[model samples]
Target: MAPAKATNVVRLLLGSTALWLSQLSAGTVAASKSVTAHLAAKWPETPLLLEASEFMAEESNEKFWQFLETVQELAIYKQTESDYSYYNLILKKAGQFLDNLHINLLKFAFSIRAYSPAIQMFQQIAADEPPPDGCNAFVVIHKKHTCKINEIKKLLKKAASRTRPYLFKGDHKFPTNKENLPVVILYAEMGTRTFSAFHKVLSEKAQNEEILYVLRHYIQKPSSRKMYLSGYGVELAIKSTEYKALDDTQVKTVTNTTVEDETETNEVQGFLFGKLKEIYSDLRDNLTAFQKYLTESNKQMTPLKVWELQDLSFQAASQIMSTPVYDAIKLMKDISQNFPIKARSLTRIAVNQHMREEIKENQKYIPEFLPR
Candidate 1:
């Protein structure tokens, strides 16, 4: 064959190969997007428990699993890219896709916990070893700041002075603005959950903003506002949105069994979920220690009894409703309610005036005003 003709043939073959490669890549991309869309559609169909269910009927079907695998694989591809811009583009797309699908996922989780025993899916995912084929599909193993709830409480204590804007001021020391107090209290509650490795991923300001959003709703009621200012809102707030999101996220990483075909990524996710679950279980077991820290923190911040304060205190309470001191007060109140405590000896009990009046009315055996 002539050298020039042979070279032309080689070029022709190369062109054909490139065309075939491009076609395959395009098909993969389309498939990925389709899978993501389908998962989004199917996610809302069941509660999380059913989604995470061991029973075949309760579980997400093979189609949804395939979608998750594609996303997970794309995530791995992004991670493997050394080019920061390219990698980030992949990550951003993955994040947006995941965020859109979050609602359906969350609904399933919360609802299913009621119908079935809480399976430690995160633990299971975390426990699963990666397969050798470069795909395990569900783990994202990044190091997370794993702090105890008490440690988080301490961090908040250190940051108390910075929390001034969230407080309400009035005639008394540490008074809170009632209207704003509930939101701030809820914000504080939300803050507690962010102490772990999962939440440590966000900047402090961003994290605070997220908490504030959640806190805004929990404090809407007069009872809730009063509850917040009277020091009952703190723990409730923590249990409410702030920490709950963190807890829920932690649970999600594991229980959702939505792994991709990349071993490293799957391992990372599994590790994070496993760590989060460990942290959550640890917090649950150390509730007593947390309670002790709560008592001490409250004593240091506000020593006034709930009955001794006037409506003026509400201003102070409201202002600092997001403060660690407020959280301390809420903790004491929660303990008093749940643990069959002697109410007379509760520590750092700073009740706002509205609560005081309610107590007074209650003492007279007047019926509590139930909100319509």
Candidate 2:
């Protein structure tokens, strides 16, 4: 039952889609899964994660219909579908808006299908209506950058008028960051699913230099982070924004949901949870592995050392280049012990006497000759 509560976003997503999802075959979901995931990465601003699913991989559309049909008694859930259906959301950025650490945080922490944002794509989902309550967004900022709180509030008002024309719905109740670090947070009760599908890896990573701030807000209960004063690592400086918090009931009419729940079949629910975590883990691990390789490469830049000898003719430069080039490569290996792929690829493509001699030397060194 408690887990059912976790499905608040799940309810909103499934409840609203009850109409359309019922009309399609389960295979439609299966076919669209990879397509939408790929697209979500491309268009983080489009809220594809909140829409027609990307969430539609299961064969349980009948049960979703059944849940809406049966759970009509739960009045709070009646309108929970709009966060998904309303495609064009008002996203007003705060802080050095140029760097949107906040938007990325929201995407990673929820069931939404958003990736890092350059967020210009507009074709993912479409909406023709204004926000339900006339205005439907809260003030968001990097909590670490609120030194000029008064100025930011002024900016918020200006942002509401001059910017993308979304409604600003809440009074600021700046959240306390438990970690004492700097984080971009939504002060409003956006009610992101308690633990994002990727929270497991994000959580594990948080312990290690804890790059991720464990995003733990459930449906209806808005939560925030503890952040540092500067960009990162230090404790967050909490200053009172002195504005009132938004009314909890305001979200009562705000509807959203995830794809895992009793509303779907048991197989669907289990797979939704397990599959998302597994896929998310692989994504995170692969990223880390790539980073490892990148670091191992030590980001070495192969300088055009020959350029320094520009006055020399091409033939003269080419003649002495062998010894210097050999020296440079050997020095790089001695220092970093890892050859970047580009260097390796280039070496393999054009192996020379220097390379051949070095390989033979390495083989000879590995089994050193006995002292006479």
How far does residue 16 in candidate 2 sit from its true spot (Å)? Answer: 68
Backbone collisions counted per model: 43, 25
Ten-residue region with minimum lDDT total, candidate 1: 213-222
TM-score of 1: 0.17
Number of the top lDDT candidate: 1
Q: Which stretches of candidate 2 lie over 4 Å from their true place?
A: 1-59, 76-128, 131-316, 319-372
Model 1 Cα lDDT, one tens digit per residue, 1-372? 699999999999999999999999999998886311111111112222222222322333332322322332242332355546543443343333345365445334443332222222222222332212321111111111112333333334334344333222210111122322212122110112231222333223233442221111110111111100111122322233544325778676665334211111111201333334446766543543343354334434334555444443343333234235635565445544543232222322344657566656766754455554
- Give stretches of model 1 more than 4 Å off: 1-30, 33-333, 341-362, 365-372
Mind giving the per-residue lDDT tens digits that candidate 2 earns over 1-372? 888877987888888798567667676876676421122222223333222221111213332222222222232332464643332222221112213564455433333332212112112111122112321222223322222323443443333233232222211112233443322222211212212222333333344532323221112221132211112233445587799878676554342122222112111101333344456775644443443454445345555355433422322222224335645454344334433323322322223556456656777777666675
Per-model TM-score, in order, reads 0.17, 0.16
Per-candidate local distance difference test: 0.33, 0.32
